[model samples]
Target: MTDRGRTALDTVHAQLDAFNAHDLDAFVATYAADAVIVGVAPDPIVGAAAIRAFYESRLANPDLSCTIDDSVLFGTRWVVAQEQVVNAGVATETIATFDVVDGLIARASMLKA
Candidate 1:
C-alpha cells in the first residue's frame, strides 16, 4: 500500500475506535469539515455538524459497536470496509465506502451487506 492508503485505513480504524469509545470529538476529527455521508436508512448528511448530530443520536445506544469483517483498497484515496454492526442484539452487515482526502474522510457511502 502507498502511504496514502495506509493513512486512509488508519483513518477508518480511528473512526471505528472513536465510535466504539463513544468519543464524539475523536470521531468527528476523522472527517473533513464538509464531509458528506450517506447511510442505509436516511438521506445524505452533509457537513460536519450534520454528521456529528447523526452519530450523536446513534451513539446513545449502549450496544452500538462495529466489527470490521474485511477491507479492500481502491487506489490510494478510497477504501471499502465491510463491517458487522451489533446493537441491542440486532446485527447488520454494512459495506461502507470511504473517500479519504488529505488523511480525512471526504465522503462516505454505506450499503447493506
Candidate 2:
C-alpha cells in the first residue's frame, strides 16, 4: 500500500476505535464538518450533526460495540469496511463505504452485510 492508502486505513481504524469507545467528539473529528453519511440505518443520514445524532442514539444502547472485520481500498480515495455491530444481545454485520478527501472522511455509506 502507498503512504496515502496506509494513512486512510489508519484513519478509518481510529474512527472505529473511537466509536467503539463511545468517544463522540473523537469520532466526529475523523470526518469533515460537511461530511455526508448515508445508510447508517434504514434511512440516510446527512452531515456531521446528523451523523453525531445517530451515533449518540446508538451509544445510548447499553450494549453497543462495533468491530471492524475487514477493510478494502477501492482506490486511493474510497474504502469499504465490513464491521460487526453488537447491541442488545444481538450481533449484525454491515458494510460501510467511505470516501476520503484531503486525508479526512468526506462521505460514508452503510449497508447491511
Candidate 3:
C-alpha cells in the first residue's frame, strides 16, 4: 500500500481499537477537532466534543462492543466498513463510511443494516 493509504488505514484501526476498548480519551483523539458524525441522531453530530458526548453514553454500557466484519479502503481518504455491534444483548449490523484526513477521522456516517 502507498504511504497515504497506510496512514489512513492506521488511523482507522486506531479508532476501532480505542472504540472497542471503550477508551474515551483515545477514541476521541483519533478524530479531528471539527469532525462530524452522522446517522446517530436526528441531526449530524458536529465536532469532537459532541462526538465524545455522543459516544460516552453508548460506551458506558458494559455490553457494548463492535466488531468489523468487512472493510474496504478507498484511496487514502475513505474507509467503508461493515460492523456488527452488540449492545444490551442486541446485535445489530451497520455499514459505516469513515473519512480520514491528515491521519485523523474528519467525518463518519453510519447506516443500520
Candidate 4:
C-alpha cells in the first residue's frame, strides 16, 4: 500500500479504537472539522462538533462496541470495512465507507451488511 493509503487506514483504525475505548476526544480527532457522516441518523451529521455530540450519546451506552470483520482500502482516500456492532445487547452487521482527506476522515457512510 502507498503511504497515503496506510495513513488513511491508520486514521480509520484510530477512530475505531477510540470508539471502542469510549475515548470521545480521540475518536473525534480522527475526523476533519467539517466532516459529514451519513446513515448513522436520519439526517447527516455535519462538522466535528456535531460528530462529537452524536458519539457522546452513543458512547454513553456501556454495551456499545464494534468489531471489524474485514476492511479494504480503495486507492489512497477511501476505505470500506465490514463491521459487527453490538449496542444495547443487539448486534448488527454494518458496511462502513470512509473518505479520508489530509490525514483525517472527511466523510463516512454506513449501510447494513
Candidate 5:
C-alpha cells in the first residue's frame, strides 16, 4: 500500500478500535464535526453530537458490540467495510461506506446485509 493508503487504513482501524472499545468520545473524535452517519440505525444521524447520541444509545445495551470483518478501498477517498453487529445475542451484518476527507471521516453510510 502507498503511504496514503496505509494512512487511510490506519485511520479506519483506529475508528474500529474505538468502537469495539465502546469509547464513544474517541469514536466521535475520529470524525469531522459535521460528519454524517447514515443507516447505522433506523434514522440518519448528522453531526458529531447526534452521532455520539446514537452510539450512546447502542452502547447503553450491554450486549452491543461491533466487529469489522473486511474493508475494501474504492480509490483513496472511500472505503467499504463489511461489519457484524451483535446486540442481545442477535447478530446482524451490514456494509459501511465511509467518505474520508482531509484524513478524517466526513460521512458514513451503512446498509443492512
Candidate 6:
C-alpha cells in the first residue's frame, strides 16, 4: 500500500478500535467535523455531534462489539469493510464504505447484509 493508503487504513483501524472499546470520544475523533453517516437510521446523520449521539444510543448494548472481516482500500480516499457487529448475543453483518479525507473519515455508508 502507498503511504497515503496506509495512513487512511490506520485511521480506520483506530476508529474501529475505539468503537469496540466503547470509547465514544476517541471514536468521534476519527471523523471529520462535518462527517456524514448513513444506514444507521432512515435519515443520514450529519456532523460529529449527531454521530456521537447515534453511537451513544447504541451503547445500550452491554456486549456490543464490532469485528472487521475484510477491508479493501481504494487508493487513499476510500475503503470498503466487511464487518460483523455482535451485541447482546446477536450478530449482524454489515458492509461499510468509508470516504476518507485528510486522514479522517468524511463519510461512511453502511449496508446490512
Q: Which pairs of residues clash in candidate 3, taking residues 3 or more apart in a chain or in different chains?
A: none
Instruction: List the lowest-lDDT window of 10 residues for candidate 4.
Output: 1-10
lDDT of each: 0.86, 0.79, 0.86, 0.90, 0.79, 0.87
Where model 5 places Cα greater than 4 Å from the true spot, the runs are 1-6
Tell how far residue 49 is off in model 6, in angstroms: 0.9
Candidate 4: the clashing residue pairs are none
Query: Evaluated with lDDT, which candidate comes out highest?
Result: 4
Q: Write the per-residue lDDT of candidate 2 for residues 1-113, one digit (tens) a residue.
A: 11244467777887888888888887887887788887766766767788788788776666888888888987777889999988877889999888887667888888876
lDDT for model 5, please. Answer: 0.79
**lDDT, residue 80, candidate 4:** 96
Lowest lDDT 10-residue stretch of candidate 6? 1-10
lDDT score for residue 46 of model 5: 86
lDDT per residue, candidate 5, 2-105, as tens digits? 13334556667778888878888878877878988888667778898898888886656668778888998887779888988888888899898888776668
Off by over 4 Å in 4: 1-6
RMSD list, candidates in order: 3.3, 3.7, 3.3, 3.3, 3.7, 3.4
Which 10 consecutive residues of model 2 have the lowest summed lDDT? Answer: 1-10
Candidate closest to the true structure, highest TM-score: 4
Which digits, one per residue and each the tens of the lDDT, describe model 3 over residues 1-113? 11344477788788888888999888898888899999879999999889889999877777898988899999878999899889888989999999999888899999998
lDDT of 6 by residue, 2-82 (tens): 123447778889889989888888888889899999998999999999999999867555699999999999987798999
Indicate the residue-level lDDT of 89 in model 2: 70
Question: What lDDT does candidate 3 reach at residue 46?
Answer: 93
- Which pairs in model 6 have colliding backbones? none
Q: What C-alpha lDDT does candidate 6 achieve relative to the native structure?
A: 0.87
What candidate 3 gets wrong by more than 4 Å, as runs, is 1-6
In the range 1-113, model 4's lDDT, one tens digit per residue, is: 11334478898998999999999998998898999999999999999999999999888778999988999999988999999999887889999999999889999999975
Q: Write the per-residue lDDT of candidate 1 for residues 1-113, one digit (tens) a residue.
A: 12344478888898899889888888888898899998854688998898888889787778899989999988887999999998888889999999998888999998975
